[model samples]
Target: MTTQGQRDPQPAGRRPDGRSERARRATRTLPAKALGWCVVVAVVAGGGWVVSRPHPGDWIPGLGPSSADATKTPPVVGNPLPPTDTDPEALTADRYFPAQRTIEMGGYKGKRNGARQGQDCAETLRARDVDPLHDTGCQGYVTVSFSGIDHPALLSSVTVLRFADDASAAKAAQALRAQENAAAALAFILPDTTAAPAPTAGAQQPRVEAVGHYLTVTASRLTETHSASPTAGASSPGVTAGASTAGQSAEQQIEAATRAVSYAAGAQFIWT
Candidate 1:
C-alpha cells in the first residue's frame, strides 16, 4: 500500500512511473542506429580514398599532363628521298646525266636485258655467273650513254643494275668490281680477248659505286691530258689565240665527271 504523496518502488531494470513500453523500445534501438550510421560513414570514407589515388596510364581530368604523354616523341614529316619501283622507267636517265647531254641508249627499253635484241644484259650478267638482274632480287636494269665534253668523239656509258635492297646491290657491286679488275689484269696479256681497257702507264680505269639499291659502272674510253699554256702572243694566221680556261687536266676532268654522275645517281634513287 502507498500513500498519496509517496512513489511506489519497482523491480530492478524497470523504468520509473509514467514511462510507456513504446518509449522504452525506441530508446533501446537508438544506440544500434548510431552504431550503423558510424559503420556506413567509415565505409564511404574508405571507398573515396581508394578512388582519389592515381592509376597506371590514366590522366586526371583538368590536372597536369600525364607522364606517358610527356615522354612521347613527335611524328616526323614528308618523304626525304625519291621513290623506288621495279619498272625500268623508274630509272630516269636525266637524273644522272648532265644537263648538256642526251641519252644515246636504253632511253626507251624497259627491261633488264635491253642493251640489244639478242644479247640481254641479264644474260650477259648470267654468263659471268652473276645471277640475272631480276633473279638477283633486283628491281630492274638501266643503261645509258652520254657524249663526253672533254673529248667530243668519246662517250661515257653507265650500267645501272637496280636491286630491291642494299645488301643485294652491295654484293653485286663487289662481284662486278672484281670481274672488272680481273678483266683489266688479263687485258695486258690478251689485249684482243677482253673488252676491258689495258692498264697502261696512264689510263683511266673503270669505277663501281653503290647508291642505295643501285650499283653503277662508270666506263669510258676517253683519253685524259693535262692543260698546257701557250706563248702570250703566239697567234696563228687563221686561228685566234687566247688564254685557255681548261683549268683541270684531262684525267682530272674525267674523274670529276664520273663523280658528278655517281652523286646524281645516288641522289635520284635514295629511299626515304
Candidate 2:
C-alpha cells in the first residue's frame, strides 16, 4: 500500500493528472466565467436594440422625413373678405332681413352671411350679458318677409341657440359652414341673377321677422295679403296661392327659418 515512487497515488483524494483537487476545481470554474461573459454580451445587444427603436409619437422636425414623420405646419390664416356693399345701412339691414330675400337682393348668403350673422349675433348676445361662445342655454330670434307686390308674404322665425354642445357638434358645424361659405362665395362672386325671372306685375317680395328671448327665439309671419279677384276666370286658386318656389311648404319654411336662426346664433360664437 505504501509506494514511494508513486507517492501512494497522491493519497487518492487528489486529482490523478498530477494536479491538486483545488487546481482541478479552478479549471472547471473557467467555463462558468466564459458563460457569464456570453450572457453579458447578449444582454448588451438586446438593450442596444431596444434603445434604437422608434417611439410611437416620434417625429422629425424640419427635414421632411416620411409623411408620418413630417412636422405639422400651422394653418395659414387670411384676411376676412371685403364687404359686398359699401352701404353701412344695407350691411346692417342684412342682420334684420331674411336670408332668402337678402340672397335675392344681391346679398351673399354664404360666407358673408355667416360672418355678418355671426358678428351681429355675438354683439346681441354680448349686449344681453350672455356669453354666446360657451353658453348652451342662450336664445335668439330671426325674421323673414316678402313684399313689393299687391300681395305680400312674410315668414317670422325663432330658434334655440347654443354654442357647440360638444366637440363633435362644434367640428360638424364648422365644417358645414366652411363648405357652405366656400360654395356660396363662389356663386355670389359671379352671380347669375339673369336666370331669375323678373317680379310679375303683381308678384310679391319675401320678408322676414324675428325676435329672441333669454331661452327661446320666436318668429312669425307679419301679415299675408292676397288680392281678392284674379283678372278674368284665372281659375280661383286654392289656399296655397302665390306660394310656388317663393313660398315653400309650411314645414320647409319653418325648417329653413329655424336653421337660419340657429346658424345666426352659432355664428355669434364661432368666430373667436
Candidate 3:
C-alpha cells in the first residue's frame, strides 16, 4: 500500500498533479510571451509619436506633416488700409488744382497745361523717381505737366500719390523729403511743343507732404534743359548759375510765385 505523503503515479502524457505536461508548459510561458508582445507595441507607438512632432529646423519632410506656411504662425498683416477705395477716382488732381496759376512775382497770371492720372508711378513719374514710390505701395498717381512759367519765371508741376494707408503716405513723404533716393518728384510731361530752356532739376526743392492716405510731391521749377552740362554749378552753390537760373530772377518774387502755384494745386487735399 502507498503512504499518505506519496503522490499518485503519472499517466504517460500527464503530470503527477493531474494536469497534462503540455498544458503545464503553456501556462508557465503565457505571462512572459504576453509581456514581450506588450514591449514591442509600446516601442512602435513611442516611435510614431516621436516622428509626428514638428519643429522648425528639425522637421522631416516626407516622414510626416511638415510645412512652414501651413504649420507655422500666421504672417504679419501690419496696419494696412483698403486698397480698393484708394483708387483716387474722385479726389484726383484735376478736381482741385486751378487751371490758372497766380503769378505773384509781377502780378501776372500763368496757365496750367493739363493733368494726367495713372494707376501707378510707372507711367506718371520719371524712371528714376518711379522706383522709390512704386515700391511703397503707391496706388494712385496724378501728374500735371510743366506750367507756363517761361523765362524770368520758373515752371512748376504737381504730383499726388495715394498709398494703402495714411501711415504709409506719411512715411513715404518723410523719406522723400529726406532725399533718401534720387526721386525728387513725378515726371513732368512737357507740352506738345519742343523742349524748353528749363532747368535740369527743380528750381525749388521738390516739396513732399502727406494728407490722409495721400502724398503730394510738388516742384517749383522746370525739369528739362537745353544745356548739356546742367550739373556744373549744382555741386558748388557759389559757382556759375546753370541754365536753370539763366533767365529766372534771383529774388523771392519768382520763388514765392512758383510755390504759390504748387501750394494752390495741392491745397484741396490738406484736410483730407
Candidate 1 lDDT over 1-272, as tens digits, reads 98898877765656666566777899899999999999999999998777766542346833434777545312211111234444344344333332323322211111110121111335224244434243456554445444333233233445566666789989877765565443232111111112334545555665678877777765544433233223223434433222222544445555655555454445556762
Write one digit per residue (lDDT tens) for candidate 2, span 1-272.
77676555455657667888888888999999999999999999998777666543244332223564233221111122223232122222233332223222211122112211222233322123323223332222222222212212323222222222344334323332343222111111001111122222422212211122112232322222344422111223344333333435534543444345435533433332
Best by TM-score: 3
Best prediction by lDDT: 3
The parts of candidate 3 lying over 4 Å away from their true place are 1-89, 98-108, 128-130, 146-153, 180-185, 193-203, 222-248, 251-254
- What ranking of all candidate models by TM-score puts the best one first? 3, 1, 2
Kindly report which residue stretches of model 2 are placed more than 4 angstroms away from their true locations once superposed.
1-152, 159-223, 228-241
lDDT of each: 0.46, 0.32, 0.54
Residue 251 in candidate 1 has what lDDT?
54
TM-score for each candidate, following the candidate numbering: 0.41, 0.23, 0.48
Residues 1-272 of candidate 3: C-alpha lDDT, one tens digit per residue: 67999876677998657899889999999999999999999999998788776533343632543455344322211122223643434544334543323334354245555566656455654555345564677776766544433432235556777777888898888767766333334464444212234344434566677878787776554333343333323323333333334444443434554466656655666665
